[model samples]
Target: MAHGEGSHNRNSVEAGLEARGAELTGRLIKVVLDGEALHRLSALQEADRTQAVADLEAENEFSPLSHPELESVLHLSIQEGRMVFDIRDSHETPLMAIVLAMGPFKMLIKDYQMLLDSYAGAIAEGREAKIQAIDMGRRGLHNEGAELMQARLEGKVMIDFPTARRLFTLVCALHQKL
Candidate 1:
């Protein structure tokens, strides 16, 4: 094959891959933690609460692997000792509700809560040095939690690493800090 032809073929392949990726980018329009979950997440300071939600929604990837075309709003709730992912379409039509036992995530959630409290305290006190270190720990925990989530949802839902991290953060927030 001519060198020019080979280059053109590669470009075509790249374009096709990009198109396919777009198809799989199932967006999460909103994520709501049901009221029964928690009254307040004291680990996060009052001021940063709103921003945290914004951060999660800013750039998240969530699509039911089984239904990539179904963009959704998710309602998370704890029911009967399990976490429920109540997914709905744009029109508020139900898509699927996945219930997962929280046992697998118990310890991870506790660790995340501790990190959040430490991180929030560091920020509030203007302890710049501590802030970076705490954030590093937070990231590590988030990565671990995300990996666990991927394994747990392997065939049911498709959430990229970042999305899983954000969702896990929210779950930690749902825990009533003691």
Candidate 2:
């Protein structure tokens, strides 16, 4: 083959490849766009306003207590040996219905934080009457308590009688000097 002819043939092959690549790329882009459009349409259809309002009203009727108020309801449920359900069930008291129906996890977390604050306060006050060295020792102990409390808040620690008993002992012992 002639030198110029060889160069011309190579250029033609390269141009053909580029054209085919562009066409394939365009088709792939169109497929992605179609998928995204369908996803958006599905989301819009799912966001039905009337259904949302009805759901909101239903939830509201079940749980009239605010997030902060959930603790008392939980306590009541525990005392009564009742299993609380967010959905309608025969065993649900009005308090149980209200608490279980709202943002249960959020309210539980908020209540946990409040309880943690009280725990921290009890630790702080408990250490106040001790000598500085003993207080320091108690602070170290309290750091462990804090970590345990964090684990409890994260649902790693299950609330049980044994755990409560240990915690009560620690709190009582901490305050003895004060």
TM-score of each: 0.75, 0.21
Best by TM-score: 1
What residue pairs are clashing in model 1?
Answer: none
**Global CA lDDT computed for model 2:** 0.28
Question: What shift in Å separates residue 119 of candidate 1 from its native position after superposition?
Answer: 3.3
- Candidate 1 — number of clashing residue pairs? 0
lDDT for each residue of candidate 2 in 124-147, tens digit (9 for 90 to 100) = 687544445444554444344433
